[model samples]
Target: MSDIGISTKAMGKSGVTFSPLKVLKGFIPKLDTKAIVKNALISLASILLFVLLWHLGANYLFNIEATAKIEKARTEQGAEAAAQMEACILSGDVSCQPNTLPSPQQVIVAAQNLWADHLSISAKKTAFKAKVATTNADRKAQGLKPIKYTGRPSFIDQILTSIKTVFAGFLLAMFIAIPIGIITGLNENLKTAFNWLIQIFKPVSPVVWLLLVFMIVKTLIRDPELDKSFIIAAISVGLCAMWATLVNTSLGVSSVKTDYMNVAKVLQLSLGKKIFKIIIPSSIPLIFTGLRITVSVAWMVLIAIELLAQSPGLGSFVWEEFQNGANDSNAKIIVAMFVIGIIGFLLDRVMLFVQQSVSFETQ
Candidate 1:
């Protein structure tokens, strides 16, 4: 018999080992990294599949019923259009007509057209700028057509406005929130005073705060010095969303092991040295985490801010898309939606890279 068939007289000192691949699914605990990764990958795939299924279902479900409803609506609208034309011929002024919504296909095409036009215009402007930078005859040489991105409503403009708002607000939030967080974490008295404020503001509804901010900024600030509309919108959004970071940073710093604090004291380190060398390093993980959350919150709140009474960013873009009734507006709407998602994801990844670069490494 082969060695495998023979009874083992003694097990190896290291003991019998089995490959994870040899085990069935669910034969491991939650703490098992191999199993966890495997399961997570599977779950991710499942989620993607579910999302795809949901999209398709949302697009078309129980085909006959959808077709029936669409056909009925189309017929009614066609009849109304004929009546409107008849009335126009008979009467000098024709105002009565059916408020017909565009089909999904029409909306998609419009959205695509908007995206193309936007890219073309953006490219032209870029090329113009480049040529102007290097040569005096750049304008004459650079003969790019003036292709506008949208029709009466400019979705591209709205998106750009939103992006500007997000970046500015996010930066401002970080500036104020981070410093205060550090101060609170470093000093007991400061922490005691600031903790209540953080707690109260953290869960405050973003909409309420934004409305209040809009009122305050618009009423108090002059439009000449600052664009109150956009600036207040951005600031309100940023302020509402950044409390988590402030609180997290303070908590992270406070929770750093007592041993490290003691070591810093023993070394007779200056306050700045203690902060930069000891305290900061210890709380990097938490700070980065908080930053990530804050930025994401800022990004998400952007749409809400824009969609509200006077949203400036992608919110306005989407609003216009919806207002267009899904015909000549769909494609631009889709493109704007994509731009928002891509920008948010990219921004978060950039922050992650920054965190990794600044953070201490452990082998």
Candidate 2:
């Protein structure tokens, strides 16, 4: 009787002891917050150190002999001229060594100036639009057609143009590559036939592709003002960037499980059903991976293509600024470079997110 009573008491104590502890454990986070904070601080420190190093290196005294004349002029011309010269050197206004490698502060100031210039241009555009509207109303009343603004493209406009060109090329590559890849993957004979062509074209440079595209486009297109450069650039980008997608998609398709094929055969599915339900769904991950690489290649190739094609994009903007060699030219180029890198990173991250969303396996 005593043993039975002890067992009952022990069972009664077990419910209250473990249940609340398990409930409280569920509220705890799996992540190590301290480690995350530590990593963030380390990244911040490294960036700060890099900026500090850049500041030191850019401002270091180089070609002191060349700048001696300016220093002498500063000493003799009194405080006003000396201050002006100093400001000019710091801002890369004077044509010298300092002008070539602009300091971080100078780049920042140049960014500000570029923003201001953009704002100024925007204001002018707004005014021009207002004038155009007034003139168009009058012209419409007189049964005449409206005239659009024909001013130079702004920085933002060039950026948008680049984006459009890249997307156009990327879409073209996808359409060409995915269909061909699927076929090649499904058929060994077709893969063998196309393998040589893929090998030959994959190593060709973007500049070479641009030249080839130009030759073809020039023969076919007679109009320059109707956006011919854009077409050529897009075609060139497509040609250069399509190989990755083609290869990956083929591999992905070929690597599909034999069991899947057996099942499809057992089910006696039609060709379309087999491709859509079995092959394409399984190959999406690799195809997307290829697409990410293709997009990156397209973006990288676009700058060179635009430079060669003289298209009104960031590539042209960089080339124009380099040729112009103004005080702020280097900084503007740097700005464009950073913008390109940032955009590429964002594109990769977006593709990664899509891959994760659709992919079967995740870690």
Candidate 3:
């Protein structure tokens, strides 16, 4: 009787007790497991099909090159030389292999090689830092600069450099565009005055921007220790990408509802308060949309700017690999190409997520 009474008390007025099984059942109904499995399977199948096609294409190109080499030997030298060429090709000699489109497997191998190279470089950097620790400390005590590692950067380091450059450019774009956009949006005359400038610069090429920035930065920044290439690339990227944000911000601020403006006036809010409390809040969705576009544009133009500026990033890596023309160079290039695409996709997704997070409509 006491046990029954205790159980009833635990159940409370609802006469129900907590059950782990019941909670699990509640969550199970919310999840469509079959659909998730189906989608996963479909994605796997698609990747496999792509790999198979790539393998077939790579083999076809290899055979064509091999046959050409053998035929050339037969025509110029002799049947004996042709047989030797065929034997060399069949022996899995890299010299006889065609340097064309790499198979998916080759790309995978290249990626692994890059990762290994990064690890090796990281180890070297660590050892170098340790070796200089005491010397660096002495230098610091003497008010001198610390010794730094000057080794070549690995593929991973290049990737990090690129990400840093893009973010720097993005921040610059935001800082310059938002204030100008707000000022212009607040006054018709300002908008009219800025319209021509925006229209003229909006269509300018990234290379042109790079050259313009290079000219200005070179004239201004005379410090030899500063990374001029990185500065030029970042500035060029910002200049090329800021127009979308500027235009969108202006449009957003101008499109605020008349009722909100009237309310702000009734409250007798200061210019700053009105902008901060009403204008910005109302314009957030469009502002975020513009920001999203700006980020995408910045990333797209970054490669070109980095290439021209000779910034130690993926752009430089690609250029170097192309010039290398080694047996594995094509594979490495393919690897970089895929990395670029994946990173671009991720950046867009991140921007989209941020936009959705702040916008009520998206929520």
Candidate 4:
């Protein structure tokens, strides 16, 4: 009994003591050394090549020659503005060639400046909120309504607006597509009827959808100044992006394994129970694939929809900057392009993670 107790104690100690590093190793994915090195080298080379091309194009091919002529012309004028232009040109300044495609460094600076502006605006918003809270407390005491901020949105605000718009559109697409897909998948006649409509509408442009939705919304909504652009943009994006999901879901449901259907029928399962227990579970993989595509399509279409609708998003910001024609406008647009690309990539990765979590196939 003493020996057994000692062994039990040893086992307990062994169970309680574990290497943290070993525990962490189990959570971390195993790396493929060769693949990792190869990918790293390829990515590095691509970035370096891009930077070299941009620098050469900006300084030698397109910008420097035109800037030199402009500088010389300004120098001959003997004005104070000429001195500033000369200084800017000498430092490889963006102001020297406002319309030229910015160098990578210039784009980086623009991104930094935009980030600074976002931070400044955020600080202002905090102060404004505090002041409003105080005033709102007093207004409430007097039985008056609290006023809201109506200031122009900042860069970050525009980005968040774009994200919100895309999500709204994506949710709307899922709601419309999933039900119709399930119903049509169960009925051949319904599927055949909808096929013609899907084929016709699937190829339609977001701009066309926006115009149609705008007309409908305009007629329904009473106030023109109301925030109806969001509704219009979201509807347009949903209409354009729902097709992939609809097609994939219908196919997935219609192709449910015969064995599964047979088992459900043999068990005398109700239609609702069979659908919920068998149909949806078996078709989840394909459904997730379609959802991933739909989200990607929604994000892509959102920019165009926002721009057309004059909505407060990155798309509108880009358009406004382009029309403003400021010296930093080109750089701001470049920065926005990077932000858009990065956000899209992140959205895809998130969907992929969700797919992997639900599906049997890891890849």
Candidate 5:
């Protein structure tokens, strides 16, 4: 009887319990599995909005023909202005002719000229100056003659150059970072002292660093070879990457658990073995994470360095394309932008895979 009474009371209590989730689950719709889906949709909407606004703004601000047409139409403003407004709306720009952002058709035409056509005598006249500073939408390509890419190499060549430079810098960073980091890890005083310097330089801007390097090279190496600019850029990038590896590696090495340190001491483990077997293996994750970050930062620096140094890397290629005062040059620049993004992503993925593969697996 007592058991039955207790069960009845528990059931009565359960009925009184308020659970919004339970009530909502029964009454409301199921929550979305992918919050990213909605976020992505929103992000896409924002991008479209930005693109639309930018197109309208650029066309309204700079498209002389379109502006002329608009002024004419507005001057003729009468009862029919509202009705005629629809005729002016074309592609992304306000125009007597239809278009805001250049249509794909226009850009495609422009892109072909950049990739294939030779420079014209007219282009040669304007080549030395920066006067062709038109926005992408304004310079949308039209007609049959395409723009030329005439990249120092080619698109593939530029991609390869940038990748090679980044890899070289990253590899050099790893090599230099390890031995020094290990030494610093073994010495408390050295580690603490250099850590301060590393912090200072790590946060310093790469652009400033490049200018400093440029000045140093100019002062020291009289008559710098433009061809060797890429090499110089890579070295600068590697140097910039040095601190992260040093700090992470030192922290990782010094952080081997106390128990492990004591075990090594008790066993009288050789210093070499202790470092190789215990310290490095234990700190693998931290060390690799630093390397990953270093490489990504190096890639960014590589592009910036290339841009400033006029090096034969992706950055220079992008700058060159942007400067090209041809119809399809903007398209080429856009393509280069995508190429840089893809390459950067791939480099990151490669490091991530390396981290995943190299980490010690628990039995």
Candidate 6:
């Protein structure tokens, strides 16, 4: 009995237990299964409701257009033409189908077609790369440019391009806004002087920014190989989006606690140290908030800027589809719309996560 008690105490010290119930508890995680089930069911129901509403709306518009077509045929070409038009529509001929809002099924089909196009494009790119590998190597030896793929970008490629453009714009906004904001925030007179400029530019339209950027980029970027449209779009997006970050950063820095500043002064911290250690740390939450807003604004303006600049991105995709007016064009546009919204939501969430990770208040 004395030896068993000693062994039990030793096991306790080592955090080793030998009970069936305790082992079972350790292996089984505690979870609120009911809550999980309830949330899943609610989400399912919501999605179903949205799909149902979309179906109804699409069907209503489709019927109205179809009825008008039939009526026009009857008025001009008599009962036989009207009957033929009705039969054509009933037979689900693409030519006779109403070019209105597409149902969910049509959107799904569009999405699948886009995916197939992406795959086909990817295969072609791979083949092109393989075919040019030897020629590219010889060109490098001869000091000439290698052959490049000149095919149009697929849907996925456009999405990636748009994402890249937005990120470039966001970086530009951060770099420009933060330094100016800090300088303005540090000096009362500077803030007062710059207030008018900030206020004036903050409400400027994205189209105006794009035009301004286009004029400058066209003059500055004379290289035929350089992507002038991308530069203009990125710069315009940056200019349009930076105001939010600039304003928020200024507010955050100016609003830093006096107590922290006093401590920094008491410690004889240098200007750089004071700004980095005291001001920046205190202003992180608000600065991140501003950054999040800036990202959102950048993404929002990017579409318009891309459209104006003729950048090969979602905006261009949307414009091209609208002009094409194919049977699947509307569905494709809707798919792009959903993709844009989802990406925007994800970007905001990512920013929020980063903000929470870095900010003490959020933590």
Residue 252's lDDT in candidate 2: 92
Tens-place lDDT digits, model 4, residues 134-203: 8999999999978777787889999999999999999999999988998888899999999999999999
Clashes of 4: 0
**Cα lDDT listed for each candidate:** 0.70, 0.86, 0.91, 0.87, 0.72, 0.93
> Model 1 over residues 150-260: C-alpha lDDT tens digits?
333345766678778888888888888888888999899999998788877788887887888977877788657456668777887779767867887888777888899
- lDDT by residue for model 6 (29-96), tens: 98889999999999999999999999999999999999999999999999999999999999999988
The regions of model 3 sitting more than 4 angstroms off are: 1-11, 20-29, 71-81
Tens digits of per-residue lDDT for model 3 on 1-363? Answer: 677565556756676776667645744667788999999999999999988999999989988888898999999999999999899889978887666788888899999999999999999999999999999999999999999999999999999999999999999999999889888888899999999999999999999999999999999999999999999999888989998889989998999999999999999999999999999888888888998999999989998888879999998898899998988999999999899899999999999999899987534
Off by over 4 Å in 1: 1-111, 119-157, 309-311, 326-334
Q: Could you give the candidate ranking by TM-score, starting with the highest?
A: 6, 3, 4, 2, 1, 5
Q: Residue 119's C-alpha lDDT in candidate 3?
A: 99
Which structure among the candidates has the greatest lDDT? 6
lDDT of 2 by residue, 195-251 (tens): 999999999999999999989999999975578899999999999999999999999
The TM-score of candidate 5 is 0.63
**Candidate with better lDDT, 1 vs 6:** 6
> What TM-score should be assigned to candidate 3?
0.90
Clashing pairs for predicted structure model 3, backbone only: none
Q: Order the candidates by lDDT, highest first.
A: 6, 3, 4, 2, 5, 1
How does model 6 score by TM-score? 0.92
Least lDDT summed over 10 consecutive residues: which range in candidate 4?
Answer: 61-70
lDDT for 250 (candidate 5):
87
RMSD of each: 10.2, 7.1, 4.3, 4.8, 14.9, 4.1
Candidate 5 C-alpha lDDT tens digits along 107-199: 556546545543453354346233433432245554333334342465556677888888888888899997788878888998887777777
Per-candidate TM equals 0.65, 0.83, 0.90, 0.85, 0.63, 0.92
Better of 2 and 5 by TM-score: 2
Lowest lDDT sum, 10 consecutive residues, model 2, at: 61-70
Please give the distance, in angstroms, between residue 41's alpha carbon in candidate 4 and its true position after superposition.
3.8
